[model samples]
Target chain A: MKTRLMVLAISLASFSGVAMGFDFGKLLEDRLNQELNKDKKTQPATTPPPAGSQSAAASPPATKQKVDAGQLGFALFGDYSPEEENRIGKQISGNLLGAVPLVRDDGLQRYVNLVGNWVALQAGRKNTTWHFGVLDTEDINAFAAPGGYIFLTKGLYRRLNNEAELAGVLGHEIAHVTQRHHLKVLKKSSLIGALGQAASSKAQGSDQMVQNLIGNGAEIMARGLDKDAEFEADRVGIVFAARAGYDVWGLPTVLQDMAALPAKDNRTSLLYKTHPHPADRLAALGEAVDGRLDGIQGKELANRFYKIR
Target chain B: MKKFLIPVSAFLLCVSAASAWASPGTVLRNEQLFSQPTSGSRVEANVAKGASVNILSKQGGWLRVTAGRSTGWIRLLSVRAGAGGSGGSGVGDVFGAATTRSDPSRVVAVAGLRGLNDEDLKQAKFNAGELARLEAGTVTTSQAQSFAKQSGLASVNVPGLPEPRPAQPSSSWENN
Candidate 1:
């Protein structure tokens, strides 16, 4: 009777162990599925949303997540976070302010912000804190830093014919921010790699390395992005402007105006150096605007622009 | 001087006329042409996919096009920018023609500018105070919306167009 009782007890213990093992396996599988679903939801942050579903409220949380993860990793490496881009943008923007003076016109600043923010809201990543500033310089130029900071020179501002024209230029700069053009250039230049190293290493030299990266980034911004990026900005800029109810021709008109200027003018010198030739830009924009945008009748708002100016 | 002025005026007229002429484009998708640029306007016609139209004018996000004598507005995103049924040569031809005008002297002059150059960037000091001030100037999204409403800028639902591929090799500015 004692031997039979012992055998029953051993069998019961083995049965309980197998049941526990099966439960553990199920738990692992469930957890993995949950993680995979979470990843799938978050991965489309960079891709554009489908048409007719572009409402700002309808945008996925992945965009917000991507922006918040700026400190994490290369966005291309599945870790490039917008928060990281914002941090880098802030640092570079600070350096830029040191290089140029800001235009302190309250009304003008507000006008630019209204226009810029309106257009930026139309973008896929609409949550960025888009800031627009007018630099108090006569250089006919505009610059975009990552993280939605855009600057336009007073010269460029004064040259614009109307609000639609202004929107076109701002839209172009905004495209750079939306597309993260400067950030891509920085990434390709080993600046981001150095930054990664700086973040990982606790050495004293890491600070210097980071500073160097910023320096290089500032240099690239001043030098201008690669031509592909500039053209893309022009293309995307018009779309954004058009999307925001501005005349789509605003960018092309501005490009034509720029092209008509002599190549040797100092006002255009910096702009010319940093951008594709106005003619090339014009032709490219011409192609973009010719048929696709021709039928779109957007608000020119010339009188309102004049009032603001 | 009079002779020169005449030739210049004629050349300018030619340029203007060339620019003013609208290029023909084909519809990439079945879309409705509205009487006005807005979507709420009366639908003038249903433009089928692959339809040909002479793109005449633009009103915000809509295009005024002529498709088979029925002139009306179509969404700008519904049409590709060239005449060919397939992707056309507009971008390629324009870029090819533009590459020949590169002037080396103008490039050198641009390199000599003072602020925001490579050396200036290298020597740039970070100004956190200025950055903070700039950030403070930002308008909230609500403020922007109110401003848009005040400005009569209605939020139109223009379909997002596909990103155009880089039509040219990186221009001369890349080497700088």
Candidate 2:
């Protein structure tokens, strides 16, 4: 089981090099055979340890090998193209919307897009178009998908006192996309995650191939990326907000508010599940920031902050 | 060990116990507190790591704090506002989410609202209309630029932060 996982990790890590010169197919074939030989004696394949993850390594190789012999290696090891990333993001976002639709207020949605786009403009990913949504749910959390889909719950939005804080929050989510954090998590499961687009509505815009890559529903969002990924987003996020000329303290202040909330707040249930404690995040951010941001004189624009009814 | 971060603004009060003159904080590192918020100012006191200080006020990236009898300004990041201190150890975490990871069945619904769960996301089906609405709301870069300009939110040239050094639990605040 360990050897099988190591093969997957190594291939995933070295994927970028395949286009440069490495014979990825041969490497994946060799590694697959080795993994198969090692796991040959082991009973059915072990599931991915991180519960709720839908990944190829978790599937028994015996069944996968027999069902589709040729495509297995590339399907499991190849990196996603930009187009593929967008489609995957769209499917995930569509499903997420089905679960909880976007906030009905057009003004709020437009305002978020404006703020999100402003923050993302500094993110350095010019080729990708971004989509920002304010989900109506009272859940106090934000989410990012592979492409450029970013969502923050209305509950979280209500907590902000200014556009800078909103920018800070948006900055964190934008960082997730710029850093390709969701894609990193999706890459693992992309192999087995494709439970087919069977459950999806045969709607006008849905892509079957992307559906197969994401697994059932939008479970990937629920599964979440690891803690390290979340911390990385926080680090990248504050910078994005600051680079856009907003107060860098926006994100940290939001963390302080979260830290002060009662332990039983249901709004934060999903957030704490996928992220480190707010206090821990603050400490981590403190390490990366310390004196580095002192020179910046950014805006906290408390007056321009839009109030929600 | 109660924290008191009384911000000048009423909305800035994060905790109900914040009725005092100043907020409490934990010093992340053993650093000098300057007489002014700037590092070029005269050093007033050298505070040790893990020491408690009262955060009197804040400037851009500095906080005016009083440590013991000595009072001076330190880098804002140098102090975390709370009695829980670094990592909020033993402090009320304000969320029961992490525990649910170990046992999804252990979810406690204290907030009355039926919060989002893994099952809902897992069982969700696509809604193309909503996705269309989301995309329709996308603002063009130029549009976003104008919107920012309206609020005087111009783009700036801030350097990216360096990843924390020492890969294993890098923050010094956590060491203590």
Candidate 3:
């Protein structure tokens, strides 16, 4: 029975990879077409619109419109190119991690890595190399950096009751990466160049001070966005999680719990400042999760991580 | 038949004395008690489960006792005289609506917040991310509840507690 269950789990994991929403193969093909178009524009209109670029006008009777990384270009730093977002996302992720002390427990690291690798296999973004790290701080926080880097705080470890919730967190961050929210923000704001310059300078600081700054930066990023952007991530996050076979209810339940925490007199703490008010997020999620994935739970994954402390 | 009857006849039907917490003396029987209040209207409901009542002041059998949350009244036998603490161990009870896996790759994602530590900051972060992903309409709330039943956390009384007084005529007890 155990072997059968393990086989089932393995099958589900692989199936999840194949089912990811964003088709990497198609996304890459679209990117190549965009490059050809640019070359044609440069060459007095003589360079053919590449082999696949012409038939892929996106307005075909049968073919779907092409969508490239740059087509998500509006999220670039005003730079209309695929390379720009990749470079920018990598740099931002690197600089951000350099400033924070990632959590460093062997057991947790292995666990996070194993789970993360499993999730990544499900994610199926071959172009993006996923790196998972745990931060040692007591702050209850985790965030996805561009370029597929996800970080978790030690404080997060102390209070978790099970693994499903962990999956929820990872899946949501995965959504952010897959949706190219970081790039979207860069494209929306002109921060990519400025951020790149900072990266080039090799900015250095103490963990405490750096954390404070990064925390503030996270708040700024969260606050400066369109509400729709966040909504998009939440929606996709559920898809990622549901497809992976974890209990989906944990998503909203946690939000409700957080929102229900007795409101503190002062909300100036860095954590609150950076994250969305749990209440608002909960309401948003409630609407988002209305009536989807009903009757999907099976006894297996629902009871999978019940041994949580 | 004689062999069967010999040892069987030696068995005695013994009755245990009730009111284990009374004053310095008597062994009381047929004891009954009501719950008391510790505080608020939302007092933990476990107190009324077989608790002893002092009848300090009662509109009825609803005497007050120190429920974890507050004081409240319970019928005389709502709580048994000898019963101590809530019926179950504080934690380890499972709670939440069950949901099936939507995608196998996204196990952690679909797992959503079920197993995340409530008090952890990482949980908060993951929660936010999950919130965003759920916007896509794939997540389900199916079920969510704490593992603890009568633990340090909040408690709700089983409704119509102690089973509504059994409907029977007073003469029946006298005949017994």
Cα displacement (Å) at residue B61, model 2: 2.6
Residues A23-85, candidate 2: write the lDDT tens digits. Answer: 443444455555445433422233222221213333334333332332233245345556656
Q: Write the per-residue lDDT of candidate 3 for residues A206-227, one digit (tens) a residue.
A: 2111121122223323333344
Which DockQ value does candidate 3 get? 0.02
Better of 2 and 3 by lDDT: 2
True contacts kept of each: 0.36, 0.68, 0.00
Find the candidate with the highest lDDT and give its number: 2
After the best TM-score superposition of candidate 2, give how far the Cα of residue B117 lies from its true spot, in angstroms: 1.9
| TM-score of candidate 1 versus the correct structure, residues matched by position | 0.59
Q: Residue B173, candidate 2: how far off, in angstroms?
A: 29
Candidate that beats the other on lDDT, 1 or 2, i.e. the better one? 2
DockQ of each: 0.19, 0.38, 0.02
